[model samples]
Target: MSAPENTPQTSLVHSAYRAPDGFEAFPVGIHHASTVVFPDVATMRSRDWREKLGYTYGLHGTPTSFVLEARLAEIEGGNYCRVTPSGLAAIVMINFALLKSGDDVLLPDNVYGPSKDLSRWLQRDFNINARFYDPMIGAGIAELITPDTRLIWTEAPGSVSMEVPDIPAICAAAHARGVRVAIDNTWAAGLAFKAFDHGVDIVMQALTKYQSGGSDVLMGAVIVRDKALNEQLELAHARLGFGVGMDDVYLVLRSLSSMRLRFDAHDAAAREVAQWLKARPEIASVLHPAFEDCPGHAFWKRDFTGAGGLFSVIFQPHFDERQTDRFVDSLRLFKIGYSWGGAHSLCVPYRMAGMRDGWQRQGQLVRFNIGLESPQDLIRDIEAALMAMQAD
Candidate 1:
């Protein structure tokens, strides 16, 4: 009564189906899928993709991405999270979801460089006004908020200048004016500070940094404690069609387990090196939030639990651009690069002339990203670089 085994029907049934259910493992399985199949037509039609009750499409999210999202949300003390292609993408998503024509957004003068660029682009293309406020404005940010202001962006320990801000005060100001507060919490890695606890509505991070820890992956996440705000971000994320590779998500998950350890190591080593640099005669100033001389060190002491491995040092007034370049080039250990939160130490010389509004320090500024290298070795590298500059 049965059909022949070699028949086309039998071949199709056998080749199309295989079940690996109930497989247990320490690591989450990488689910590389674009199309998900349903057991029945009714099941497929009834599924709500937006709620994350079940898998819908690869672009929206996969099991791997969901796992990472949940973990990141928990770490950030948020209820919902959406991962994006990069930190900048997350910022764009927030902007697109929240801002419209006749709306305005406020940014810290010393925010991440690319963020300012994106704000300018939005202003040009979308007619959304972009305003820059001093990072230390704190509650005084209220003065800048207008009837048209819809969003405010904050960055603690302002990017390369390393000036900490009064996050709680800024949040209070923004919230009182009915404006949403979003912070670039990359420096904290969502570990050094509790963003939502300070009244921040949206918290974003460049997971490419500490979460990946290898400096090999580039991914970002936006976390929100409110459901409505989360819905807006989710809609923008889906429309943008941003999707992260499963392998990269898995790498971040793997690194996240060791993130705390690595962060602590980096924090300790950086303090030692910074102190050494501060003591050197060639240094004009060390812009570290943990130290009193930094612009908002008091706020940093009040808000942050710990400092990360990023800080900038201004060379003596005599060190010109050429000398600074020589110093950066002569380093044997610290590689010159833009990003941070890796095992390899990095350094970059920056001209602070036009980047900030109130910057008064003379001489060239060099930012350092301390890595897993021994503190003494990094110090020696800087010492040698200084010596090299002296010789030249």
Candidate 2:
């Protein structure tokens, strides 16, 4: 349901609107459609099920989802893209399409929390062999690929720790082995990291986060390069009944119009906060890909164009898990929450042990989802929390 990269300006081919007739001025309108009427029984019958030539049911495809997919494909520089109910659904579609019971999949140890959980489930339930490799594996991934391996899942700057991996190296290794490469590009949101440009065959993202521009809608999308793999995913998607709500699709489209602008704000504000926290005595280090202490700052600088609003800050030597909780609890501007990419700032504490590989990084991990707030105010809030932590 995505727009072609080489689409001519003649008209919006997939768009329900006739551009010659003059579409509405603002590009932010939400196209709400559940059931689209066909011209005739012949046309409906002739519709291609293998591809999204046309639609049959609401759950299958809608005008809003179709338009969103087109725009997403344009953004990701991919040939095809599809919308799903959530980010995990998009991952599941890719997995179910590419791998079978005996097939093997390589996943980076530094993946999204839910994605890691899903991989474990896929191993136990589907009997698909999935293994986790370190995010720093890079070109060394060539050593892990086997004939049975079908897919490789990677996430740049693993969620909590923000470790930007050598995406190109990883993709080259997987692609050389004739394996598919998919990434949770939700962190970069196609803004910081261009997946298709890096040889990624498939790009998966949580549109619910940055794309929605709000915390309301839950949506995800998967971008594919080849038609065959895209068709396979489409079949799995149809069988699984994975489709986004029409209203949610509308909301996502509404947010997408200003996606670049919102991402700009997020990047600026987050950099400010990260820089501020780095200078603070209560903060041990800033775990942002753009920062020096981050796991792969060199890779981030080399491969990525920019950073996002989400990052983590390690507390100073004096702070422990208890003080970290106290600081989070004492915050006024920041809410203790899991997800990011909303209008509100969020803070979540994670145990260093839960995401460790025998590394001796000393600090309680506090993930920050910076909102569209004034940097000065967020700085003030952090100062207050630090004061509270100091008093405690």
Candidate 1 global CA lDDT score: 0.91
| Candidate 1 collision pairs | none
lDDT of 2: 0.86
lDDT of 1 by residue, 259-322 (tens): 9999989999999999999999999999988899999998888888888899999999987889
lDDT for 87 (candidate 1):
91
lDDT of each: 0.91, 0.86
What is candidate 2's lDDT per residue for 202-321, written digit by digit as tens?
A: 999999899998899888999988888888988998888896777788888778878888888988999999999999888888999988778899999888988879999888766888
- List candidate 2 stretches off by more than 4 Å: 1-36, 357-359
lDDT for 283 in candidate 2 is 84
